[model samples]
Target: MSRIGKKPVDVPSGVTATVNGQDVNVKGPKGELAFRVHDEVVVEFKDGKVSVQPRTESKGARSKWGMSRTMVSNLVEGVTKGFEKKLEISGVGYRAAVQGKELVLALGYSHDVKYPIPEGIEIKCAKPTEILISGIDKQRVGQVAAEIREFRGPEPYKGKGVKYANEFIFRKEGKKK
Candidate 1:
């Protein structure tokens, strides 16, 4: 039995949830989102809560049970509170700015790196060294943040580059003189 699958996802007030076959859709104050669960699991909504169950006792079904349940719950949470990822620039002269719908980054390169913002995702530069990515889709927000960080990953020597705000960089000892 899957522990997480046993718990139902409660639909909070002012939020709407619907289950159609293997598809689950949630609409909340933040926005709307949907997810398609695997056929190995069954989805149902009753008494203001959504539940997931394995179709059979097979191992494949059991393996998807918990994952399907969590995906449904994430849809509810994502549509309500949304998701956010923050990145910090640590290198000298490295900074970020939003130009219209694009993110202009200066990572010590000869030319500035321009990243076009995708739909449904919002990118904001609270400070020259801070980048905030927010969206209802958790995957999209994370992907965008990863793409931005990929431009200049943190180096182990000086630990200089772009990284998650809460991330810890492992520093390496400098070369011998």
Candidate 2:
């Protein structure tokens, strides 16, 4: 039995959860999110909580039970509290700015890199070198942060480039003269 799958996901006050067939939808102050569970798992919303159980005594069904529960939990939390990611730009000329709906980046490149911001996600430049990404969907926030960091990933030599605020970069020694 999956330990996490056994615990029920509580639906807080002011938040609503509805389960229709294999589809589960959660609505909260932040936003509304929906998830479709696999046929092997049964989802229930009762007594202000959501629960997931396996439909059969099979390995695949058991495996899907825990994942389905987690997905439901994430949906509820996402629509309630939402998600956020922070990025830090390091380097002599590395900087970022929000120009209208575009994120203009200067990562020592000859031409400036312009990234178009997508819908439902908000990008803010707290400073020229600091960026904040926020959205109701956790996966989309993380994906946007990763794509921004990919523009100029941290280098080992000087530890310069864009990276997560809490990320640790291993340093490397330079060649001897």
Candidate 2 on 1-177: residue-level lDDT in tens?
Answer: 999999999999999999999999899999999888999999988999999999998999999999999888888889888989999999998899999999999999999999999999999998999999999988899999999999999999999999999999999999999
Off by over 4 Å in 2: none
| Highest TM-score against the true fold, candidate | 1
Candidate 2 residue-wise lDDT at 94: 87
**Model 1 per-residue lDDT tens digits across residues 6-104:** 999999999999899888889999888989999989999999999999999999999999998888888888888889999999988999999998999
Candidate 1 pairs with clashing backbones: none
Candidate 2 clashes: the total is: 0
Alpha carbon lDDT of residue 54, candidate 1? 95
As a whole number from 0 to 100, the lDDT of residue 22 in candidate 1 is 83
Q: Which stretches of candidate 1 lie over 4 Å from their true place?
A: none
lDDT of each: 0.93, 0.94
Provide the lowest-lDDT 10-residue window in model 1.
Answer: 71-80
